[model samples]
Every structure is written in structure tokens, then in C-alpha cells.
Target: MAKDHGPTVKDDKLYEDLLRDGASKGKAARIANAKAAGTLDHRSSELEDRSKADLLKEAREIGVAGRSKMDKAALVKAIRMG
Candidate 1:
């Protein structure tokens, strides 16, 4: 059977915060906040110039592991981080 790895320290805390507010948030929100706070790899400013397709290609080139599954916005985020 596959193992169930629990949430990381950071994710756990963020989830808790969402719960406290009675607003269930998705992974994107957590990722965005982390990025904004300079904790995640990508900064919002860096992705401004690229088109979505270009961003996805760049993300793949930069070795974002799940590039195939990522959408344009997510690709932008990952590329910036990478």
C-alpha cells in the first residue's frame, strides 16, 4: 500500500488557519501566500513578462517535477520558483 505522508509543519499550520476562519482554502492559496511571503521559490514579479505557454515551457526546462500536470498559472508560479 502507498504510504500516507501527513502534512508538513508549514502546511499543517496553514490548514489550521483556514479552518479557524471557516473558509476552506485550496493548495493554491497556501502556495500563493508562501510565495508572497518569500518562503516558496517563486516570486510574483518574476512571472510578469512570460506568456502562459512560454511559462510552461520554461517551467519544464527549469525542472519543475510536475510540469506536465500544471496549468498556466501554476506553471508561471513554478517557473518563477525554479
Candidate 2:
């Protein structure tokens, strides 16, 4: 069983899985909560369509390593693979 992460974490198991997958604590909590709320199914822009800055921001959110040194295409790949 997973340890309780307090009330802010709506889905503890999903949050733990995201953490194991390299997501930051905040990102894991947010995604888990969104999944519990049934709002994670919304569509977003393709990685290519988003600006490099946007990609960097998302990479930072998801705890991608070496993101600062990567270019736009690399950022897209990292974000996708991440």
C-alpha cells in the first residue's frame, strides 16, 4: 500500500505512478487530481505547435533532466518520451 500524501492528492496511486515515471511532485499531484476529476481527457496542442518556451515550461513541470541544453526538437522529443 502507498503512504497517504494528504488531502491535496486526490488519487494517491496515480500520483505515485507519475512520480515513478519522473514527474515532479506538483505535476504528479495535479495530473492525479485531474484524472480523478475526469478532466485529463481534454486535448492540447501538439508538441510541435507549442513554442520552445512552452515546452521548456512543461519539461520543468514534469522534471525532465537536461532540458535547458535541449533545442526545440529535442524538447519535443523529451516531453513526448517523458
Candidate 3:
């Protein structure tokens, strides 16, 4: 059984699995929480169609730095990479 990582971690099992698969701490937590919330998405291709403001919002949500100066393409890349 998976041990609880704390209240901040909504899906402990998924978190551990992601860790085992070499995901970064922040990345694992984000994925685990999103999975628990049923918001985890694998739609990288659709990012291109999103506006820069939308991508920047997502970047802010994921704690991406240097977002304000990033162009649309850069924002999309940053958001996708997050």
C-alpha cells in the first residue's frame, strides 16, 4: 500500500509511481493531484491553438519563471513542458 505523503498530495500511489518513473518532485505532485482531480491531460498538440494569455496562465499555475517576456511559442513550450 502507498503511504500518505500528506494532505497536499491527493494521490499517493500515483505520486510514488511517478517518482519511481523519475519524475521531478513538483512534476509528480502536479500530475498526482491532477489525476486525483480528473484534470490530467495529454494534449500537447492542442497547446498550439491556445492563446498566449492562456498559456501564460497555465505557466503561472505551474510556477514557471520568465513567463512575462516569453513569446506565444515560448509560452506554449513552457506550459507543455510543465
Candidate 4:
């Protein structure tokens, strides 16, 4: 069973599952909270469909390193890994 992560973690089970799947603590928490808030179903645009400028903007928002130097494909990969 998953340990309770207290009130701040809205979905402890999902958070534990995400941790087991190698997601970082922050990432898992964000996803868990989003799921609990019923907002996870709203998908963002696919990386492949976005222009380089759009990808760069997202990369910047997410604080991807060296985003200014990354190409579209690289940005996509980085965002996924991030």
C-alpha cells in the first residue's frame, strides 16, 4: 500500500505509482494534484505539431536548460524528459 503523503499530496496512490515509475517528486506531485483537480484530461498540443517558436516558449516556461540553442526536435525530447 502507498504511504499517505499528507494533505498536501492530493493523490497519494498516484504519487507513489509515479515515483515507482521513475518520476521526480515534483513531477509526480504536479501530476497527482492535476489528476485530483480533474484537469489531467485536458491535453496540451503535441510536440510534433508545434512550431519551433512554440516549443521554445514552452521550454522557456518549463526552464529547460540551453533552450535558446535547442532545435525543435531537441526541445521536444528535452520537454518530454523534463
Candidate 4: 10-residue stretch with minimal lDDT: 39-48
TM-score of each: 0.38, 0.54, 0.66, 0.63
lDDT of 2 at 25: 83
Among the numbered candidates, top lDDT falls to 3
Instruction: Write model 4 residue lDDT over 1-82, tens digit each, in one string.
Output: 7799998889999999999999888778877987899876333568888789878876776679999998889999997776
Candidate 2 is scored at a TM of: 0.54
Model 1 stretches with alpha carbons more than 4 Å out? 1-46
Task: Encode model 2's per-residue lDDT on 1-82: one tens digit a residue.
Answer: 8778999999999999999989978778878997889976334568888788888988887779999999999999887665
lDDT-based ranking: 3, 2, 4, 1
Considering TM-score, which of the candidate structures 1 and 2 is the better prediction for this target?
A: 2
- Which lDDT tens digits does candidate 1 get at residues 1-82? 3222254324555555545665434443455356446766432445766567767755665567988888777787675454
Screening candidate 3 with a backbone cut-off below 3 angstroms (N, C-alpha, C), the clashing residue pairs are none
lDDT of 3 by residue, 39-65 (tens): 876555488887777788778889999
Query: How many pairs of residues in model 1 come into backbone collision?
Result: 2
What TM-score does structure 1 among the candidates reach?
A: 0.38
Pairs of residues at least 3 apart in sequence or in different chains that clash in candidate 4: none
The number of clashing residue pairs in each candidate reads 2, 0, 0, 0
Report every candidate's CA lDDT. Answer: 0.57, 0.84, 0.86, 0.82
lDDT of 3 at 5: 98
* By TM-score: ranked, best first: 3, 4, 2, 1
